[model samples]
Target: MAGELNGKIAAVTGGASGIGLASVESMLSAGAQVVIVDRDAIALKAICDRYGDAAIPLVIDLLDPVDCATLIPKILELCGQLDILHCNAGSYVGGDLIENDTSAIDRMMNLNVNVVMKNVHDVLPHMIERGSGDIIVTSSLAAHFPTPWEPVYASSKWAINCFVQTVRRQVFKHGIRVGSISPGPVITALLSDWPPEKLQEARDSGSLLETSEVAEVVMFMLTRPRGMTIRDVVMMPTNFDL
Candidate 1:
């Protein structure tokens, strides 16, 4: 198990921070070289420095379909082959939709929904030709339940959930595994944007999870025996109310 991923190369979007950063660290420790893709050039460089030769940092905007299309080819250029694609980049907007501007909604949908579709579309052909690969996405508990506070965010996650399920079947014939991890209220910068009262409530109730917890699930999905493919995993703090 020490070199479970000895020959694999992985690309993690949003890999500069939070759950994405945690997954990057775990994959590297599991004996895989990883490409850290994010818009934060500074953080990407810092992570690449920390991991040295194990990490290749690519600074790119996930919201741009054009940029998303370029990711796998760029990754292949850097690492030679890509065996895993972790689409962990996403954005959130809270409060009632009435108060959310149309442009804000568009940005949210573009990042949370469009980017995932584009990444998968662009990566599928290469994966299919190779006859094997894995695609893991970061979904959310919000996808399973309607949350009034972050309606748009929840809807976006729902879209990803559907995408994972449908695409998993499509790629199974090609030996590709597609799945998602849905975590509730993780203590990441993503949660830093929550309304002040909601953040306080989650903190007071000890219902916030750490980034590493979700990262563990990512590794779990990757390391499963080839005969067994975990389709979805939902992770939440023990005390999480919803």
Candidate 2:
């Protein structure tokens, strides 16, 4: 296992499944103290059993500001340091711009942008105080690719991309590196929610990017030398028409 991250403390939101799960494994293997935060209690319990005590699993609703506040002290208690915050939780509600439902739009904006902003707000002060930290956020290829059919998801990602980029400029001098990773179609159970008929078509048409592919880039960003920062990483499968 790679140990480049040894002795580092890495906090990962949405760490229970998908790319988050891959990151948890990679971070632990790289010898970082890993904290997996998610709202899935059963999955959280399973992760604790699977990764042992060093892989601390916390049940959290990212939409809650108090949850983020609670997270900081826990990290201090468990690892005595906070060197990385990997914000990788995201959700999608499909609809064309003209046909989108109001509630769906709200859910996408609230869960994606609002929660991320809150977590960043809560962590930035601590990172700035330490004068050394890395913030890795999950942006999306859709942010750049025009997808009016998925307007809310694409727009939310676009907002996050700008937010992280701005933070990179503001905080890099303060010893914090802020960056984003935008991956192609990541193969997760989340995609399986589509109808079985559409699922095969989606894969055949171009939607087979694996979660590990994106997780690898995330590791690349967080594990680089202290003085360097990977400003932005945007990638999609060649076959992906998007």
Candidate 3:
């Protein structure tokens, strides 16, 4: 039998590292042609070199609305048509609101919240026109809880959660599926920024999640049959408190 995603085209944002990198590898293994989008030009070029024709690298910042608008069209120009979009690029800022600098909050919101909105806005029209597509946003478990340790990061996720649900409802008739994966405390560079005490606590408690696990979930969501849609997947390590 053929690979489930053979002949499909996918675009993965923040595809240079961590969960984004893992997701890109998974999609390629499943026989999809993918365009890896990221601001890390060096890393993106390396991936393209490693994967050769299976990967196309686009090095551009997603913060600009114009860049987001051009992304899908550029992906289509490369691979003909788009079948999947993984909005997996995001940043995390951990600390109390008072202690955190205003600049940090602004950057976090712009990256985690605004960028996501722009990408979705740019991609949705094409998906609607084609009447088929799958959109998977990399959400956080914080979206479902009051994560006092990372309130701004939590707020960004909360906004994404709402966007995914509302957009799913709006586009269901157009044969597009929009959903999010809410994973708890993934072991990525993002976690490196956590307070040392909090990191130690999670390490002692064995609550840290691996990036590949999240990639597997993204694969699962994308490979489902046409008529089925898994709206939200809430994933957490067994010992995590929230």
What is the C-alpha local distance difference test score of each model? 0.90, 0.83, 0.89
Q: What tens digits encode model 1's per-residue C-alpha lDDT throughout 60-135?
A: 8877767767888898788777899999998888888888988989998988888988999989998999999999
lDDT of 3 by residue, 55-172 (tens): 9999778877677678878887888788899999998887888888888888888888888888888888888889999999999999999898888889999998998999899998
Q: What lDDT is obtained when candidate 1 is compared to the true structure?
A: 0.90
For every model shown, the clashing-pair count is 0, 0, 0
lDDT of 2 by residue, 44-97 (tens): 889889888779877878666677568767777777788899888888866667
RMSD of each: 1.3, 1.9, 1.7
- TM-score versus the correct structure, for each prediction: 0.96, 0.92, 0.94
User: Whose TM-score is greatest here?
Assistant: 1
Q: Give the TM-score of candidate 3.
A: 0.94
lDDT-better candidate, 1 vs 2: 1
Relative to the true structure, candidate 3 has a C-alpha RMSD (angstroms) of 1.7
Cα distance off (Å), candidate 1, residue 62 = 1.8
Cα miss at 51, model 2 (Å)? Answer: 1.2
